[model samples]
Target: MKSYKKIAVVLTTLGVIGVSGCKKILDQSPKANVTPDVLASAGGVVGGITGVYSDLRNLWGTEGFLYYTNLGVDETLAGGGASNGGVAFATYKNYTNNVSDVYNALGGVFNIAYQDINTLNGVLQYGVAAFPDAPTRTAYLAQAKFLRALYYFHLVQTFGSVPLHTTFINTATLSDSRAPVADVYNQIIKDLTEASAELQNKPGENGSPFAGHAATKASALYLLSKAYLTRGWSSAAQSGDFQSALTTAQTLISTKATYGVDLYQNYADAYAPANDATNKEDLFAIEHSTDTKYGDFTPGASGGKINGWAYFFRPNYPTVNANYPASGGSGVMTRDIANGRPFFRVRPNYDYVNNVAFADRSNDYRYWNTFQTTWIANTANITTPRGSLTVGTDTAIWMPPYDPGADKRASFKGVIFLPPSVAAATTGANASTNTFFPALKKFDDPNRPSVNDPSSRPVVLFRFSEIYLIAAEAAYKLNDLTTAANMINVLRTRAAYRTTGMPANAVANMQITPAQVTLDFILDERTRELYGESLRWWDLTRTQSLIRRVKLYNAEAAPNIQDFMTLRPIPQTEINLVTQGPPIPQNPGF
Candidate 1:
């Protein structure tokens, strides 16, 4: 997007430099026009390194990875909600994931990650001190190292043991074996710890004119802590990883002011696009701009500025004819577009709403604030026996439990329709798309020229609130229940702020006890706070709770899920290309 002006030019430069490589970096064949010397130059290295951030944006900016990560989790489901689309991701949830589709979704993610790794290596090859100025050199190198660690962390988590590439190579190497998961964690820790020491502690662009999409000391530290926490959960994890994670998280929480990060008093304030730079809760985000006519699509073929992800979380309103015998439906559910295009790619599960959000609906504000239960009519296109529905004011559709059935179309005021019920009588074959569920409203972007146009809202990658969760989880693992409960209470108290009509101690009433400090409890807490974010799948996998949770929460994914479903299939292309050295093995049970 136009917002990050410094890196905008570098994105185009990547194409000119011909960042062309084989399936992986094994075949290092960049364009000859771009010699090593040119790349080694201070200016060239800076420009080349900017491309890596673009890759980050491309990787997380769209619905592809989000679909893979959030869909199969207990909180959300993949597939058309009251319509049809997103079947590929449904494959993952249903445990029917094959090499071709899984490869396409996650395979593409792997290639992009290495592409980023290669870019970072190219910059590191020249050495950080090579840059003209001392401060600039340190910043650049730190950013590259931070990203390298992040890429590897994602790889190791998603594919288990993966090919680890640290340095830039000028020649082709036929085979690369999967490094030990422990080895990958070591590298990640080394990179992050080093990066955090050298990076700045400045706040990112919440909405400032200055560039806001770079790594910071806090960002690196937070991720380092998270990395430690994730590694601690591994089968071959080392001793004291939980303590290490706890210490790091404690450092982050205690040093918030020094790091230029603090939890937002209001949850909605954290996501407001207009205040990206000013939002202290945001430690790092993929900054985007609405300046482009189409929106920033550099991260991938699509982005928040193009077919933005906001629409994917919508419900198929007009397509879902809840009003039978049309006492006249809200003229084809026109108002659904006001919430943005309804790709209806992802919908929250019933239990996520009823058991979690609605469990404390009186005291907790997250349920109402995070979801859209009502949708008004934006246009009038259909007619029935009743008078024509008015636009903007008439209720077009309403979600179930709130839907007021018996075909009262003329008087229907609530505007959103829910997906099919989880019960067998209604769930039937189209259960995936036929039910009524509240759509996620967190990514709302009404500025798009059309439903297909992407919103330019910056996709937040990390924030301060999650740090609390991390600390709580790490503490729970270490049996430090006091610290765990306190960390969780911070968020609970914040959420209770929305209990305006409820009791003064409603939020305080939401706090958990030491006895409630189980892994499942923490996971459920995470769901209430970070439902739509892409962390669900990783959370489920790391806890080794995929099968248990899938069976309990996700019906579509339960039957097919197995222990091996935790790690995705290694892309067949990578396997085929590696014709030498130890036969680059695919993840077990793929």
Candidate 2:
């Protein structure tokens, strides 16, 4: 076991939380190591305890969240939208469910959450009594509980009733079984409520642009509302849960004191690469800096760029920043719906692409955010840049052979970081080769350092916009279609204009008729509003749309998709250490 040797001082209520409270405590001290003795000093304990959040940064791995968010959502499909068809996306679609048929990626939601619980338990076990200053130490406890709540939130959504391990268990006896969904939800509710109370007005770190700092009261309430909304709709929450959800969410939103935030007219500005937090629209994000994320953390083969390497990359297609003077990426959006239920029908008929009245552009104020012109190895296909985005040009492609861990071959990291071969593919005065595919325009940052700088940028984990979507969905679920439609307009109007191929009176006429506000409509609305973010799969599960959508939307690949896949199975490998009994049964239908 690794010894976390730097704990400075115990920063809790000045009393040692008995070890009996937890099955185990971290070995804060080691022979030759300056163990985190801080458990004794209030300040040192807080600092030492902060290590509990170490897993947050791991969410952006190649096989992790950086790509999963897009797969989970309906905003964009892996293959239909890109050339490689989002090769990494198979793990995300609904058809695969929990099974050994597929190899486990870095992000096993169950394992990750359990590990986090263990981390929190360690801090709570050693630091609560061990903190030097009880008040300061208590804040850490709140923060720890808050984090635990977030982890469980992700868990229950994905797996339904995950093995809710509250106390730290020794790996030797990690035989804990699954907890009922209700039990999991109850614990989550308890944790968030307490954390919000203690951390009241204590907003997360304004210093980091990313989600590094802790969440604020708004964050907690936002979560509370989502939890209630999910439960209220679930078979378990048939009673007054919906009303309770509304009240909790409303209370948090009502507090405009710290709730109000700036919204950037230019979407491209949101992902700029100044290696700093410059966007005013950001409510909360994990701030990354060069020092905080280096080597493997950088955006290269060795240090992949999961941070900037994100969802909705405009690949070098449809010509965003046609004047970008660099190699572009692939993955384009097609104008015609690729023959599917919602994908083909929802986009405005035609003439809406350039309509200034509804929605004009998807990028920022900079002209480059729109289109980048470049000659590539395969540049002959141009039917219409309208609905047809360049194949995988808009998606963020990385340097394939760069990272041995990922073992990607011939990958293009970014427009600016191309190697001699890839860069040579782009037509420069002396360059004869052409690297194809229009790169994604959304993740573009004019301030990026030559594409390889291990720089940190602020990334939103949760934002005010999500609040609006949640409200809209919740209202729709409560049978208030009018309210849902009204709220939905708030996001749509911002994304489009009257001229954007919509009914001339689109917004004015835009109403989710009570007849039209089915679970599907709400699902589509969620997709449009929160595309490319990691909320899709969870949203699908909560709404009971996973299996249906998976079979329908992914019919083309259904032959390869396993039908029994619904919930993920406990990684037999990870759970084999359990002394509880024979291996736990896999989630039903998985």
Local distance difference test scores for all models: 0.67, 0.47
| lDDT by residue for model 2 (305-409), tens | 345433234332223222234345332222111110111101110111112212323321222333232323223243222222244453322222111222222
By TM-score, the best candidate is 1
Q: Model 1, 357: alpha-carbon shift in Å?
A: 5.2
User: What range of 10 consecutive residues in model 2 has the weakest lDDT sum?
Assistant: 340-349
lDDT of 1 by residue, 1-590 (tens): 00110112233321112211212211222332223565676655655565565556566746667667776678777745421114445545433445354566676787677766766776777755456666666666787899899899888898888877776655556667888898999999999999989887773222211146567888898999999999999965889889989999899889998977887766776666556656788777765554442224433234322335676687666564434323444435643336666666677777555665456766777777788776666666544334454667765555543324336533554333334553323321223242344678877876555555666676778888999999999999999999999999898888766524757778668887888888888888888788788888899899888878878877776766777778877877777777765777777776
lDDT of 2: 0.47
The residue-level lDDT of candidate 1 at 485 comes to: 92
Per-residue lDDT of 111 in model 1: 64
Q: TM-scores across all candidates?
A: 0.86, 0.66
